[model samples]
Target: MRTEFDFAPLYRSSIGFDRVFNLLNNAQRLHAIDNWPPYDIVKTGEDDYRITMAVAGFAEGELDVTQERNVLVVKGGRADKQEGEYLHRGIGSQSFERRFELADHVKVETAKLANGLLSIALRREIPEAMKPRQIAISSGLSDQTAPLQIEAEKQVA
Candidate 1:
C-alpha cells in the first residue's frame, strides 16, 4: 500500500524549498526501481559525502557515472558473453542504473572501484560571494567616513 502526503500546508510557510518537497514527492511515487545492487550513502565530513555501491561482477570499465544539474547517475553493465552454462546463477550480473539527488553547490570529487566496490566522493563548496561577511559600523562622526556632516568644523578639518 502506498500513502500520499499533502504538501500544501508546507508551501505556504516555507520559502525556496520547492525542490526538496518535489524530490520527496517523486520518491514516494516511484515504485518500479529495483534493488539488485546494494548501496550506502555516508557523510564523511561537515561538507563531504561518499556513496559506496556493491558491484561484484562489474568492473571499472563497465560502469559509468555522470552528473546533470543536481542529479548524479550511475550505470553499470557487461557485454561479455559467458561461454559456460551455470546451473544456478546468483551473482547478479544484470545491468543496473541508480540516480542520486544532490543539493545546490554539491559536486562530485572522485570515483574509485576497488575490491568489487564502487565509491564516489562528493563535496559541497559554497562560493565566496554567497558566504557570510561582517560589516563595519562607525559611531564617531568622521568627515571622510560619514556621508553627511552635521557640523561645519568637522567638514573643514
Candidate 2:
C-alpha cells in the first residue's frame, strides 16, 4: 500500500518559512515508502535515545552505521556466495537502506550488535548555559542579600 501526503495548503499558508517549505517539498524525503529490516526508536531518558534494528541473518561486519549531515544512515549487505544446488532458499540476504532524521545537538554515542539486534545509542547534552537554574527571591529589603542570589548573578556574568 502507498500513502500520499498533501502539503499544498500548508505551503500556501506558510510565510517566512522558505527553508522549512523547501525541505518539505522534497517528495522523496517526505514519503518513506520502504521498510526493510524493521527498526525501533526509543527514548531512554530526557536526553538519551536508542535505535534498535532487527537485523536477522546479518553479521556485525556486514552492516555499517554512519552519521552524515545530521542524518543517520544504516546500510546492510551480505557477502556474495557461489550458487550451489539447492531445492529451496527461504532466507533472503539482500541489501537495504534505512534513514533516520535527527534533531539538532543529538549525536550517536555508540553502536553495538548483540543477539541479532543492532542497537545504536544516542545522547543529547544540554549546555550549562541552557540548563534550568533556580532564582532566589528576597522577601524584604535587607542590608545583606541572599547568598544564592549572589552566586546566581556571578554565574550569569
Q: Kindly report which residue stretches of model 1 are placed more than 4 angstroms away from their true locations once superposed.
A: 12-15, 140-157
- Whole-model lDDT for model 1 versus the true structure? 0.92
- Model 2 clash tally? 0
In model 1, the Cα lDDT at residue 85 comes to 89
lDDT of 2 by residue, 1-157 (tens): 7555676788788787765655556644555557678889999999999999989889988999999966899999998685987698766678998877776678999999998889999998777898899998866655476566443434544
Score each candidate by Cα lDDT: 0.92, 0.82
Task: Encode model 1's per-residue lDDT on 1-157: one tens digit a residue.
Answer: 7789999999999999999999999898888668868999999999999999999979888999999999999999999687898899878888989999999999999999999999999999999999999998876655456476586555544
Q: What residue pairs clash in candidate 2, if any at all? A: none
Tell how far residue 134 is off in model 1, in angstroms: 1.8
Give the Å error, residue 16, model 2. Answer: 7.7
Superposition error at 116 for model 1 (Å): 0.5
